[model samples]
Target: MSPSLLAALLYAALTLLLLMTIAALRATLVITRQRTADAFTPAGDDVSPFSGRLCRAHANCCENLPVFGVLVVTAALSGHADITDPTALWVVAARVGQTVTHLGSGRRRAIRLRFLFMLVQIALLTTWAARLLWGAMQ
Candidate 1:
């Protein structure tokens, strides 16, 4: 598989992992035998902070995955991957960093770091697309 496609798959897999984390956390909190349906039915009643962070992280992943997927797929099919490969690598790395920072959310510095990582990934994506476009126009 092309490296850009591989990177896109990696991001998709990471998003799935985040989703599973949220699901697992919710299950642990909501599926206890001692609790009735009423107690667990409503959100924000007893969700863990970590679970909340995981939720946000998953949300963020969902928000970015579509664009990233499109860009990576286009790059993979473009046949001009000189910039795409490095951009893919950098974007994946930045995504990992963002996920880690998001998992450690709630701190000011952590939030800032997450934003920085997200910006880096966005920048890489833009660069990848621009390179592909430029190559196509040549």
Candidate 2:
């Protein structure tokens, strides 16, 4: 498989890991009788600060996955995976960095760092898409 495809799969795995974390945290709360299962909100603030961050992180992944996936898959389908391969793994690394920074702290510096990581992913993906488009036009 191409590195671009592998990167996309890694991104999916990371997203799933975040989801499982939310589930485990909620389950622990319910089991301890600290809260009811139905009491959890989509915003996750009803639970804890970390839960809220977790929700946001998971949502971020969900939002960006398709954007990255479409580009990677399209490149592969059109035999342009080479265009995306160089920086594809870097995008995934940046994504993980963003999520870790998000979950690590709510401080200003952490937020800034998280935003930087997000920008890296966007820049890489945007460049990849442009290259793919240019290649297809040839």
Query: Of the candidates shown, which would achieve the greatest TM-score relative to the real structure?
Result: 2
Give the Å shift of residue 25 in candidate 1. 1.2
lDDT per prediction?
A: 0.76, 0.93
With candidate 1 superimposed using the best TM-score fit, by how many Å does residue 125's alpha carbon deviate from the native? Answer: 0.9
Pairs with backbone N, CA or C atoms under 3 Å apart (clashes), candidate 2: none
Model 2: lDDT of residue 6: 92
Tens digits of per-residue lDDT, candidate 1, 1-138, equal 777778888989999998787666566655775444455422332566776677777788888899888777676666665667766867888988998887877799998998899999878888777877787788
Best by lDDT: 2
lDDT of 1: 0.76
List residue ranges in candidate 2 displaced over 4 A. Answer: none
Instruction: Give all candidate RMSDs, comma-separated.
Output: 2.7, 0.9
Model 2 per-residue lDDT tens digits across residues 28-105: 999999999899999897788988999999999999999999999898888788788989999999999999999999
lDDT of 1 at 19: 78
